[model samples]
Target chain A: MIYLLLFWEFFKIGLLAVGGGLVTVPFLFDLTEEYSWFDKRELIDMIAIAQSTPGPVGINMATYAGFNAAGIGGALLATLSEVLPAVIIVYYIAKMLKRWQDSPYVEKVLKSIRPAVIALILFAGLDVAKETVVDWQTAAVLVVLCAAMRLYKKSPFFYIAASAVIGLILKI
Target chain B: MVGLWQIYCLFFKMGIFTFGGGYAMLPILQSEVVRKRHYVTEDELLDYYSIGQCTPGIIAVNAASFIGYKLRGLGGLLSATLGVISPSLVIIVLIAMVLRQYMDNQYLQWMFGGIRISVTALIINTVWDMWRKSVVRVRDYIVFAAAFGLMWCCGLSAALIVLLAAGAAFIPDIRRLKK
Candidate 1:
């Protein structure tokens, strides 16, 4: 029953999280509230884990949520559920590329989705900021990173690594 | 069957090297998969990236699956998916095992603290880039603002919000059809 629920929950996430992985965070927040599977603090921890680790944040959270709720099998079920919609969609899209390649409606729909996706991305940025920028020191790091990105065009990994080092040195 | 090893190696490199996930992986995938390898064209990759965003799974995995399926069907899909996930699986297992002990360590905490801030910046940067490249009209601006406001202020379920937005988008078309 738990596995089925896990699959269904993630399937819905997969089907609807149209923008990307970060866009799923808000939904997962609501999901945790409803399910009692994990609490807000754990969700933060999952975010940390998901961000620090590889793979998509949404998939990582789903796996962790499933594991918390129902162990290994649940984890597998959740992961598979999360990917299933994409797999199916991509498969069909791949099949129909030739037919739909020149469709103006398709182009228009894609064009329309871009703004919504940008909105979703902005929401993700705000959500992460609320969690990470609690203090002035961290806030400074954010400013510096943003400047580096905008002004210098420095690689993001460099900023990430530099911030980690600064955090270690300053104990902030 | 054809050049399977090369494909696996290529995706594995992408999976391992990308630090910020999804958006960050875009350029890397574009360079290695599209420009360097000639596996897919830039337009196709952009389309794949768009579809990857709308679909579930890791965008990297979705991208890999599409590329793989395009190249060699099921076998390609499995290989690409595995390749995309392999690095993360290994890294996460190691971190999960070791991180609990370091949870209280000040250095580790500070390092993660810094990383968290940087992650926020990266996300903002990506968002800005997407907005510049995308959002074209006033309606687009309105939709973007509305969605962001609803999510941040109301803490609404994202799934429901997206559905409402999609329905709202369709309403005009539906009315036009009636006329």
Candidate 2:
């Protein structure tokens, strides 16, 4: 029964949280109010774990929250339910998109959407900056890393790992 | 032709590397998919992201499934989607079981803080790349400013902003067609 409920809740999240991973955070907050599966503090901890680890934060949160609710089964169920909506919806979108690939209207709309989407991504970056760029040390890290990344083309994993070591050594 | 296993492996690697969220996946995708593999062109990637934003579900997952479908079909879609989430399943479950106790440790917190800064830097780099690739026209600039302002100042949701941009672009097309 809890499995069904978990599926329903996360499935709703997948269906409604259209934008991205962080978009699901608010919905999870509401889950804290509705169910005793995970509390607000635990949610924060889950988010921290999700962000620090590799993988999509949304799915990570879902799995963690699900496990909290009903162990391994709950975790598996929630992850599957969460992705099911995406799998089904994007399948059709991809199918139709192929036909529309050459359409002038699709091209024109995509042309405009390209910039708008970039703006949204930039806005997301600013939001993260607001949270992470708290002091001079952190700001320095961001600036230096940005410059270094632009200069040398390396996999993102390399920089991420390097930053983790820097963080550990500096204890910042 | 790309094999389903290859699709799965690529996304699995992407899942392991991605931090933050879908936006953070952009750089990894740009490096791996566009640059290394040549499976999808840069424009196709942006297209997947744009559509993925408006669609239901996680953006990264949506994009993964989309790319998977384009590459192989239903099998590819399942492989890609499953591949990406597999890491989250294993890692989060393990952490939930054992490492929950250590989550509050000071050293880990400091490490995460540093990791967060790096993720931001990555996002900034992605924005630069997208701007270079996408924002060419004066109209595109206007749309960019409008979308950014609406989201930042007005607190409008991203889906609505995308719809508005698409609608605004569509209007001019209608006018051009009538002319």
lDDT of 2 by residue, A29-99 (tens): 99999999999998998888898788998999999999999999999999999999889989888889898
lDDT of 2 at A67: 96
Off by over 4 Å in 1: A1-51, A61-85, B1-60, B63-77, B96-99, B153-179
Cα lDDT of model 1 by residue, A45-105, tens digit: 8777777565666666666777677766666677778778877777787778657868876
Estimate, for each residue in B10-107, the C-alpha lDDT of model 1 and write its tens digit. Answer: 77877765544576566556556765677786556655765666555567668888888778877777677767765655555445456656656777
> What local lDDT score does residue A111 receive in model 2, on the 0 to 100 scale?
85
TM-score of 2: 0.94
**CA lDDT, every model vs. true structure:** 0.69, 0.89
